[model samples]
Target chain A: MVQALIGIGIVYIGILIVLSLRSRREIKSSTDFILGGAKIGLILGFMTFAATLFSTFTLMGMPDFSRTHGVGAWLFLAFSDAVMVFFILWFGFYLRKRIGQQSFRGMSSLLQDCYQNKGVGYLYFTAAFLFLIPYVAIQIRGVAIFLLEAFPDFISVGFWSVLIVLIMLLYSELGGLKAIIYADFMQGTLLLIVVWLVAFNCLDQVGGWASLFEKINESNRALLSPPGPKGLLTPQFLIASCIAIAMIPVTQPQLSTRLVIMKNYKSLLRMAVAVGTFAMLIILPTIIIGLYGALYYAEESTSGFLGTVLLQEQHPIVAAVTIIGLFAAAMSTSDSQLFAMGNEFRGLLGASKEDQLTPVRVAIIVFAIAALLFSLVSSDELVLLARLSFSGTGIMGPMIILGILSKKPMGSFMIWFSALALLIFILSQLNVVPQNIYSFRVDLALMILLSLGAFINYRLKK
Target chain B: MIKNWSERKLKSTWRIIYWSAILLIAVTFSPIVLIQDKVDPHWLQMPFHLWVSILNTIVLVALTGVGGYVFYTLKSKTDNDQNL
Candidate 1:
């Protein structure tokens, strides 16, 4: 197994290096580097989009989530993803029509232009920075801890985290967004294949789907229903989660940038459908794998369960591929996010495109280091932490949507209003404020308020 | 005159599909689909709630495909009319 892991790991890194070096030659300008020349076709666009959206969280976090939370985890992610892809069809059209293909620098810059205010741009960049760093951190942290468990006699978790960050920065800095997209294509394919392979094996071991569920029913019937044993998947929580997840493409820079960079509307639409299909296919298998854990490794720690199911229980070659797949998942997401932040920072600059690349590259390095540091200190509750990141960025969704959709010169009220909402959400996360107000989650309440405020502001300005 | 009328009809139909997709999403999250402890009426040996939610997701994705088709048709027609 160790030999297989070493062989496969070398091959994977070899591919990444080759792809990055090859992509580096194609960069003629900052736009080409930052936006994949803004001409991504259907297949590339779909792969990158799915890869960025589903990551370490999908592979490592989700199985444990389902094992603990039950089938309702499906609604929390897969169903929400279904709704989100449909939304991309609607929102992507309007956004592309407004921004055009070539003129888009980043969402921050676009918002600055729309509101004719720098504060909006600052607000957007700050919010993305605050939320996305933790997200990237968890990806690094997830893979690092898993590696530690796999190679218990290997390097420390912090060293593994730094190594991952360094590799990510090296490739992304060399080839830019194009390199990241190519890497994403490879990562997304591996993620799907590896997940389904493990799931099929688990299912077969459990004597197929019928017997699997029958065993689950006998062991813990709550696994079959909503609000499982822990009672966490309530209606309000699921609804809020859906809203947050749906808002992802609207507010998350990595995904929204994908929408803007597609070759055309047709490709974008096709990519949206493909992603929805991918979401269902990828998530279905995790349920089987999770249920397998529920029956066998139910009382085990997260790392223990994952190490056994994803590695020890598998063939040597399969386990090697799983390790590489997990690494791919983490890097696929972290690099795009780091790149997107750099692009957003570029968008806020007053410098020329030529001058912008230097600062942008510097910012990417800085952001990757911050994520590496955060990963060392971050918690193991991957799914909930990921949801917080989604909900946090989602606070800006209404503000972003209004800026894109409204024709009038909307005033700066929403900029400040969104800033306040973001502050409150952060405070709630830190326990400085209650997470719920009058039995409504503060994040949901803030989303409602921001949406309403944006609507009224639009009407008054018009 | 015929083009104008058909384009307007297409626009309206697109709007209907758009709203229906939204409505379907809302319904899926409601109590009807997410009913707790209602594990009967199993499909493919899966529980009631799980299968219903899965079916709803498939339906939603299908609706998105339909919506995308209608939107492209409406958009192309409008673009053609403008070109003329």
Candidate 2:
């Protein structure tokens, strides 16, 4: 198993290095570096988008989510993703029409131009930085912890996390966004194959699909329904989660940039459908794995269950591929996010495109280091932390949407309102403010308020 | 005039599909689909809500494809008109 892991790991790294060097040659300008020359075709576009959207969170976090929370976990992620892809269709069209093909720097820079206010850009950058760093951290931490537990004698979590970050930084710094996209294409394909293979083995062990659910029913019937045994997936939670997940393409720079860099609307449309299909296919297997865990390792720790199912119980070669796939999934997401942050920072700068690449590269390294530090201290509750990141960034959705959809010069009020909402959302996360107000989650309420605010602002401006 | 009318009709059809997808998503989370304590009507031994939601998701993805086609038709027509 160790030899297999070493062999596969070397091959994976070799591919990433080759992709990076190839991409480096293509980086003739900052546009090429930052936006992959803004000419991504349907297949690469969909693959990169799916890879970034589904991460270690999908592989590690989600099966555990279903194991603990139950089938409503489906609604929590997969259904929300279905809705999100549809949203990409609508929002991507308008956004592309608004920004045109050439001039979109990043969401923050676009917002600055729309509102003619630097504060909006700063607000966007702050929200993304505050939320995305933790997200990237969890990806690093998730893989690091899993590695530590799987090979208890191998290395410390700190070493694994640092090594992952360094590899990601080197890869992204070498190849830029084009390199990242190519890497994502490889990672996404590997993730789907590995997840389904593990799921197939787990299902076979549990006596296939029908028997799997039957065993789950015998263990905990609540695992088959809404709210589960722990009562976490309530209607409000699902709805708020749905809205937050749906807002991802709008609020998250990593995804929204994918929308912009597609070769054309035809490519974007095809990619959206492909991503929706990929979301369904990828998430379908996690349910089986989760149900398997619910029946067998119900009392085990997350790392214990994952290590047992992903490594101890699988074929050695399969386990090796799973490890490499997990690494790819983690890097696929972390690098895009770190690079997107750099892109957003570059957007806010007043420098020339050539001058901006150096600082942008510097910012990517800085963000990667910050994520590495955060990963060391962050908790292993991967899905909830991920949801928090989504909800945190989703607060900026209406502000971004209004900027994209409205043609006229928008007032500054929505910008400030969004900023305040973001602060309150952050405070709520810290328990400085209650997470719910009068039976409504604060994030949901803030999203509603900001949406209304944007609508009214548009009307008044018109 | 015929082209304008046809484009308008295509635009309205696209809007309908888009809003219908939104409505389906909203209803999927409501009590209609998320009924707790009711796992009887199982398909392939999967629970009621789980299979139902799965089917719903499939429909939604299909709707996105349909919606995209309609949108493409509308967009292409408008582009053609502008070019003319």
Candidate 3:
């Protein structure tokens, strides 16, 4: 088992290195480094997005959730995706036309241009990198754990995670955007295939759809629908879920630039529908793995149902796939987050005196390394941090809609709104958020409402 | 004339079906996207996770519908140009 795992790891690393080396050849210009020379086709773009979006957390956690929460577990994926779908619709066509007017415009640059505030623009640059670095670390650590079983005690999970981060950084540094995109294309396909394998294994074991649903009901009826746990009910849940969905376009840096890359103005809405659907389709297997683990293990005390599967079977490959999914998730998030951060800094930050690709590669490596360290020193893995952070960014709706509208003074307004949103989210996760409004719901409605108020105020003043 | 109309209608038929089916699944699965299922329900006899399938059902349909519209529109435009 160890041998097989080891073999896969070495081979996988080699494949990535070779791919990155070739991708490096294309980095003749900054454009090639940043957006794959701005010559991405639909397939590569889709794959890159999917690769970045789909990852280890999604891979292992979906199954874990199915086991623990049942049907309601998928709410975030279904709804949050709609935000991106809407974004693609709203921006893809217009932005394609807009990009035609400008040679190179990153998301932050777009914001700064629209808002007409350099300070606010720089703030966005700083904020994106600040939040993203820790986020990427969580992803790197996740991949490391997956690679652990393959290694001797010589390389700890943290080491493996950092090693991969370095690998990504090296390629990203050398090969630039071309390397990341091509690698993303390869990684994304592997992730999809892995998803299918896990899904198939789940289906075969669970006895198909009819049989699976039967199992769901047999264990807990409440798991099948909303108002799930009597205590889980709250207006906050519904609102936050929706707002989170609506805000997808703004929060995910990888998502925003996709529009900048597309050649046609008409493809946005089409891509939205397609990508939204694609996003949901990809989410299915993780949920299945979660449900399957819940049923087979039936261990209420299991830390995570997906992890329990490994303990029960001692199946290294299956375990590896799940781990890889987590890695994929982290990689997806890290690469995109790094990519977005790099783009933001190359223009707005004080350190804009360099090639865009070089800064970006350094930024990605630095962020990934920091995240790994934080993951090692911090409380939990990226998955936990991601979820907690997601609940925070879930309110990114008001920020994107309102901030984008009024590029006038009141940079403070946007910053405060984002800070307040993050505060409410943290409080909610910590279970100290205003319980008087409602009980134990981790609500963000009031905060978003307040942000919306501020946005309105900004506009009124404008 | 009816055959031509029939073909056109057939082409658009997927739009409605695709949209509706995607919506159904998305709606059905919204309650569950990526949340952890704590236990099995009383109704079913199996222990399988339906979240993946539920999400897949919705997404696949949405793609079929929305993605289909793009390709179809592009194709129709070319056909018109060819005739022109």
Native contacts retained, all candidates in order: 0.57, 0.64, 0.11
Enumerate the candidates' DockQ scores in order: 0.49, 0.54, 0.13
Q: Which lDDT value does model 1 have at A110?
A: 89
RMSD (Cα, Å) for all candidates, in order, is: 2.1, 2.0, 6.1
Compose the digit string of candidate 1's lDDT tens values, residues A1-462: 999989998999999889998999999988888887888999999999999999999999999999998888888899999999989888988888778634677889889888888889999999999999999998999999899989999799999998999888888999999999999999999999999999999999999999988898899999888888899998888888999999999889999999988888888888999999999999999989999999999999999999999999999999999999999999989999998898888888854653458888998999999898889999998999899999999999999999988886699999999999999999999899998989998988999999999999988988
Q: Candidate 3 overall Cα lDDT vs. reference?
A: 0.57
DockQ of 2: 0.54
Which window of ten consecutive residues has the lowest lDDT sum in model 1 chain A?
A348-357
Ranking by DockQ: 2, 1, 3
Instruction: Give per-residue lDDT, candidate 2, residue A132.
Output: 99
Candidate 3 lDDT over A1-462, as tens digits, reads 555556776776677678777877767766677666765666666766666665655665455545655555555555456544644543443444334546454656766665565655655555455555556665665556545543445687667766777666665676666666666776666666677676777778789867766776677666565435443422345446555545545665666666566544444445556566666767766666666666676564333344445433446675555454455456556767677667666656433453645555666666666676776765433344555445454445455555555535445566565656555655655577663354434445555465667657676767
TM-scores of the candidates in the order shown:
0.97, 0.97, 0.77
The complex in candidate 3 yields a DockQ of: 0.13
The better candidate by DockQ, 1 or 2, is 2
Writing each residue's lDDT as its tens digit, candidate 2 over A1-462 gives 999999998998888889999999999878888888888899999999999999999999999999999899888999999999899877988888877644668888888888888899999999999999999999999999999987899899999999999888889899999999999999899999999999999988988889988888888999999989999999989988999999999999999999988888888889999999999899989988998999999999999999999899999999999999999999989999998898899899854653458888888989999999999999999999999999999999998988887777698899889889988998888899998988898988998899899999988997
Candidate 1 segments whose C-alpha is farther than 4 A from its true place: A351-354, B1-5, B79-84
lDDT of 3 at A271: 50
Which is better, 1 or 3, measured by TM-score? Answer: 1
